[model samples]
Target: MYHTWMRYFTPSPAHHRLGLVCLGVGLQHGALPAVGPRVLDHHVAVVISAGRGWFRGADGRRRTVTAPALLWLTPGVTHHYAPDPDTGWDEAFVDFTGPATAAYADLGYLDADGPVVALTDTATARTAIGRIARAARQGNPFLEVETAAAVHELLVALRRVRADTGADGHPVLQALARDAFQPLSVIEHAARHGMTPAELRTAVRRGAGCSPKDYLLGIRLGRAKELLVGTELPVAAIARRVGYDDPAYFSRLFARRVGTAPVHFREQQCRSVPGGFTDRIPDPSRPPTIPPSAPADDGRRGGG
Candidate 1:
């Protein structure tokens, strides 16, 4: 009889590269069905949709996974997974390639040589994935925007999964990491948590291996890079958005960290386009997704 739902599909470059690189979602289900013992030729990753399963990696280690969780499997990573015979399993997956994929690698989420990394409490992630799956299936003109939003949501949810582990740091530091997207000065951030700047810096350094200022700067830079490549905003506008008042200073800072000036970075991204990265998602019907709501400023509310 029916045990699990297991279906898989590959995204075309039109959907994968142009809409959002490293962005595609699928739903899988079947009767006692599961991916057979094999290695993915492409970076195939999944988050469980329903039921329970176990993943055996190349290193001979096994990780038990359950519904509403994430599993990242890189290309050629020998692995096998199957749903429980009784309960079966359901899953959603996405395959992607792009600079953002490198970010995942930096965070140690991509392991081509070992067992799966199980992400806990992935309900939010599943929701985002589902949204992307629907978008992919519909092949909507605004598919790119939909997939981009879904990808952003997935990252936010995945980051939350890491925060919940409460490992490698104090709870307070972990909490700070969770909310690092807030636009606050280091002193202000410390004050909110009843800590002095020095104490906060020490705590973060000891626990997360980075100072609070550096952490915040990394967050800003990441956002800046996204804006530089994803949007058409001028460098000066992006600089101000990321807390740099001087465009020239922001250019230098970006160059130091990203190995290229803002303009050059944008140029390189455009030149290195993976065939479909710039194709307008062909739908004039749907409006663009609005940007995320900004946090209130420190008594600087209300723009002219």
Candidate 2:
């Protein structure tokens, strides 16, 4: 026979700071009944602590899911998974949502396309999930806050696991993380790591699934978006903050890459979330605060 326990949570408004919110948590031991090849509205992370199963993703591919693995069920993605009837499994799962969840997927921390991720440290993953479950079960007045913090811990654990297992791609990713905001060209970046430009290109492409230039631009754009929404900075100031010297060129690039003007994007975000801008900017009359100084070049001239 199997044992199962689960809890669903309704997060309060204050729980939104972590950029991720726990909707529910569940723990089960033993066989799982076959679940649908249907879509879900929220993301569910199923961590298998023991035994085995099979997972089918939207692509209709069935992959064996062994213990110490994670099966990610992304929102609107059709998926079906279940433990072997004969062997069963021990599983812990958390349902969650928030802006940062999508960002994680984009950053390759979570695999939205591939459903199963083999974990190097099963105990660590299990412990993190267990903490989330325990917090949910406690039913404290601060349940939302506690669960949210635990969810962040879970994500950090996942990131560390991914990094530990990904040895070959580490240097390129590290370089990008360290210097992406600066004005270093791809060639200069490559040279810093004692690699040729072509070698660097190959490494970045293999690691990030994008060219070095594109990856760097993505970093710049992401920061620009954050600045645009969170602060009342002018277009030029926002551009410079994100490493762009010429505001006009930055505006053009932002429009082309992001599908909207910077001002429009900020306005749209403000409209979507009530008081988002006002909450960030307490006094409308005051000038926007400037970000710390960045490298002056930012490889803008090289256009790499």
Q: How high a TM-score does candidate 2 get?
A: 0.61
Model 1 stretches astray by more than 4 angstroms: 3-24, 108-115, 118-120, 162-213, 216-304
Candidates in order, TM-scores: namely 0.53, 0.61
On a 0 to 100 scale, what is the lDDT of residue 279 in model 2? Answer: 26
On the 0 to 100 scale, the lDDT of residue 23 in model 1 is: 42
Model 2, residue pairs in steric clash:
183-298, 183-299
Give all candidates' CA lDDT scores. Answer: 0.67, 0.80
User: Top TM-score: which candidate number?
Assistant: 2
* Cα lDDT of model 1 by residue, 147-240, tens digit: 6667666755665664334433467676666666565778988998899999998777644556787777787788787777878889999888
Cα-lDDT of candidate 1: 0.67
Task: Give per-model CA RMSD.
Answer: 13.0, 14.4
